[model samples]
Target: MELLCLLLYVTVNLACIEGYKWTRQNLPVLMDQNTQLLEQSLFREQVENMNVGQFEKLCGIECQTSLPPLNQSEQERILGYETMYDNGTRTHTDVRLRGLNTTESTSYVSSLTRTKRQVFGADGRFVISDLKFITNYPFATAVRLSTGCSGVLVSSKHVLTAAHCIHDGRYYLESVKYLKVGVLHLKSKRGKRRRQRAVSKINQQNMKKRPVFRWIRVKQTRIPQGWIHSKNSTTSLAADYDYALLELKRGVKQKKFMDIGVAPRTFQPARIHFSGYDDDKSLEGTQGGEKVVYRFCSVAKESKDLMYQHCDAQPGAAGAGVYVRLREDGGKGRWRRRVIGVFSGHRWVEVGGGEQRDFNVAVRITPAKYAQICHWIHKDPTQCKTV
Candidate 1:
């Protein structure tokens, strides 16, 4: 009788575990808009395979048979073409050839002058961040991409990042062999330090800490056509349209994700926050080790597609989510943080007369870009209308 009772208890526990696993696997998946469109097409060719006529037809620029005409707001949101044609009858094929040899004519020269008001120091503006654990709200949303870039979770399965990190204008970067997203695990620093110190004395059976990262493979990636440019295309290299969306093969329901918000056209000077895994700060012998670093600064300048700021950032900081705090709608008492831009790293621009100026730039999310990204997240165009 004793043996039978023990067997029954074990069977019930095993059944419960199996049921939980089944429920977890059946959770709904968030879909990307671009991926959905590509899947619906009859031909499975790469996007580059589409000719100018086909591209226009599919994009609803020519026949308007496939998709409806974009409203003024939507039109404003679309990242314009890389180059302009005199005849206005250009195609992607023409863009490929013509855009290759063109050069920017505008030039302005300026020095990297430091001001009391500017956050201009090499490492002053940025600091190593201690995010406690994966339970933190915004920190939990941060993810490290295998391509040596940082990205943020906008949905359970979608990651938003800079296009250049994955594709450098022409082809995908060599580092992007198999895209992967790494989410940091929750571990106490004091406990970790103790474990490291006792490593020589402790046997394998005594250690209980989990691995640092929970890595998930990426299923698909999407970037705007405007970001693909010829080698000599100056405007494209300005990093105006440097944004991309990644869809992971599995959803990360354990960690929270961030919401998207539009940056106001004009407002009082405000401080914006962003965090990323900066390479310089994450070196093996660095004091902080391989931890996420954070920075905040005031906007220096704003253009139609980009925002200039003085945030101190290194190469690996590209694709960090630029977010700001705002109150909830309808005068709700709760405050929320929403991502308004994507950090595109440092850029050198011609101010005028062949002179160059250096600034850290971010790709601002306009209403249209917000809508497009929302569509990517929900796979429903109607759901993105709120932005």
Candidate 2:
């Protein structure tokens, strides 16, 4: 009788502990861990509600350092400012680098500049000796929507791109838009070969449907963030949550759509490939509307908060996906390609300039990005892969 009573007491205690854990996971405490986040979100909404030249003094988000005073030059350059509100009045100001509040004097496009070059190689087949060294690889295409950006379908309605490519402020889909990807000509022997290989007469059907390249509009975009941009008041620019998933308007008919695979923990820098439209190229010498690919090596050093990779690109390629191949453990060490970043591009200048040789910031995509994107991918029962 005593033994039975002890067993019952132990089981009851275990159940109580499990119940407490379940409650903690599902319930919210008034002062929760996301308190800073809540504060930042409220502050951003207040700032976004302000009009040009209508900012409140000392209006800023929560941070250790005192907010900087807005200089005339800085005031006119606010892209997306974060503000503080007290008693229904505005109080602080922290500016974004692009979008919404872009001031004419302080916007990224205002400082736009680039050098155009007319690439040449051997006639017919490409010759390795004729092009720039290190920049001799092939490139793929990428695109953008209201939320974020995406990539092209290797040969079908399915497009292989980033997970954070689409966002709508919150966990909503209203901000999503159609997919628009275009391929471009590269300035290298290998780039030329890939271009020819892509457009060979034998592959005429694969020839982009339009001169601008037929864009396969997106039907749906999926993301796994329950609360995007944070419901709190503090927003960290640090690299943490990135990556998203996008679905094309139609299912790809071919079997070429494949994941880039995974990245090894110890990755190396190499000559990375990219493709995009350069408004400067057209301004200087490009013919009517020619699609082009660009190849360039990433900078040797990288910034902790900023993602960097070298590629000849420009503003129009803002949403371009940056990718690299890394060796992974698959029984033995095997080389597989994985996307590590997105072309947030040079928020401050043109792409691939001999200038600013240190950091070419790209948005780093990590495992968190993959999980968020994949959750969106397999969300709907109908869209889930059959296995």
Candidate 3:
């Protein structure tokens, strides 16, 4: 009887330990979602009371040193100053894009062609991209979300993506079982050739050249309060604030990440490039063979919060980075690429009188949004001061 009692105690303890582990693993997601909802009223009250320091603390951000005030003209050009709700109520919050003080005042000219193949047409659908693996700029920066969304690495351990990809307006999606980021593992040349030979000789089921991916679990996720709205609220459909930032449990090694940048103040048609694991093109024999697909096109139009383009993309392409090349340090010849937007995917906007217009839209990374994202990435407002 004593032996049986000992075994029962051991079994109960083991079960308790397993349950604790499972709860601990999933606690962050539950806490984050509930915190955001419960803190909504308090956040609004604090913002209304102008308690900046307390507000920052509650939002999981450290208080930042005051930045140099922008001039009147600069303030006008920046976003968030004139942000309005669907009901025409303007937001009083001031969010500035960081890291823009170093950029030149003049607009940067783009060298891309104006006309390109339409990505939405029947012939343009499911088009395979020509981007080489691990040898390209944007391709190396793109990562796949376990939720079937695409994301871009903004920092070594942070990913920038669309908020809707992880959470709909009301609740988190079912596919977000656990936040994981998958990066492609490039194979050595010798290993690639050997695998090819093995594949030819071995049976299909026993092929040794299976694609490899390194998946890192996500530690935390943050979504803008603006993106969270009631189902009946018009702001729920607004795609302007559809961006999110994810903090990975660990850093990616040996892979390059893209720098986040602000969109140009003035509208200038420019070529934007993005890579993603589109679902339609994920099957074998498709373009890129289950690898990340790249696409580029000139900007069609720009609103205060969204950029419309015809980049060939499917459902799974949501949350991909929309990036452009710019002169680095205002140098005469040196150019650097930076991500300026988060792809929001196809959206239908109410035109008027029940008419809706469809367009492929990306949420522009305004200065205010940049500050918020940077805070999420670094957890310190001071570190994000420079963008």
Candidate 4:
């Protein structure tokens, strides 16, 4: 039953892309759907309660120093998206991202913002090279997008990812025609000594580049009209809706996909976590092709639509699921990890006075988005009536 609920939670629309009648009827049902997500906010509230003193210790001495005020501009923003069916149909709908008054402790927030460059210099990323751990729950949910990005499994046949991955709101990327999803399956090691030496030596060739995923053909892809560029709006605003869903040809047997969690736009947490495939250079040592890199950090800014952070990331990390681990409601301290946003990667934004400032952004899934995504995965509005 939980699995059924999860799949129902996974689907939604990206406008007219898939030829779905995402009419007014669908929107109202989704807008009025039951929100069983109260506990999700409860867990988020607990995370936001961490005080500046606690953060001071965790953030270390870097917070004690200050860096020049920053404004950013970058090309890695999630912009332009569309829904494409395997048979060659397309759709789109616009979602908006807006900021709200932040009430988080200013002091604690300052600590994290200050450390974005000061402390995280030279890359703080770690590789999940251990085959045993990488091919299991949580980590196993991470997958590689054919377009040189990364994504996470959300339902049996659906994957959640950045909208900008396959579409630019105008047309699909060149790779979209031959899109594929890669699943890194676990394999038996031939010799313990060889395995030990390979792992110790950090030799990906000796390891046979297991980073190569088990490839799966995509049945369809969906993105919001909001991500599509137009004369009426800018790409930066479209980024708020920079999310997409891909349906695979089949389900992954006996594998686990993550559940969705939602928090208020203004809410802030002590830490945010995510993992994805990146090139060899971003890692500590040479990693041959690509490796699943994981990192956690505090959010610098957040709004109704987007989240900004300074977590170390490089090319190919886009579309990775940004998740949080918190205790389940009434589970008596039992913890759960749920995906709350899709990493949008680096974005250089032109701010006031025509200055371009860059940010490592993620698109937070708002209730409206959750419902739309759920509708995409379930294909039935009734199943998507609750988060």
Q: Each model's C-alpha lDDT?
A: 0.55, 0.32, 0.54, 0.58
CA shift at 167, candidate 4, in angstroms?
1.1
Q: In candidate 3, which residue pairs clash?
A: 96-367, 97-367
Task: Write model 4 residue lDDT over 1-96, tens digit each, in one string.
Answer: 445324322321111021111111222123211212111100011121122122112122233123221111111112223457665655443332
Clashing pairs in 1: 33-376, 107-352, 107-353, 108-351, 108-352, 108-355, 109-355
Question: Considering every candidate listed, which one attains the maximal TM-score?
Answer: 4
The alpha-carbon deviation from the true structure for residue 357 of candidate 1, after best TM-score superposition, in angstroms, is 2.3
Model 4: lowest-lDDT 10 consecutive positions: 37-46
TM-scores for all candidates: the values are: 0.62, 0.44, 0.61, 0.65
Task: Evaluate residue 82 in candidate 3 and report its C-alpha lDDT on the 0 to 100 scale.
Answer: 18
lDDT of 1 by residue, 10-105 (tens): 432232221011000111112232211111111121232111121111111122122333343223223332211212122221111111111211
- lDDT of model 2 at position 36: 18
Superposition-based RMSD of candidate 4 using all C-alpha atoms, in angstroms: 15.6
Clashes found in each candidate (C-alpha, N, C closer than 3 A) = 7, 42, 2, 32
Model 4 regions more than 4 Å off: 1-28, 31-82, 91-120, 189-211, 230-237, 282-289, 330-333, 349-357
Q: Point out the higher-scoring one by lDDT: 2 or 4.
A: 4
Tell how far residue 103 is off in model 3, in angstroms.
19
lDDT of 2 by residue, 1-387 (tens): 445434533432232221011000111001101111113212122122112221112211112023333333342222122111212222222222211121111111111211222222321111111112112222333332333333533334434443333332332222332334433223222336667776767565444332323444555433222113444413312222233344555653332333432222223434333443433333332232243333334443332212444444543444445555433443244433345455544322323322433234454433223322333344332221211
Total backbone collisions, model 3 = 2
lDDT of 2: 0.32
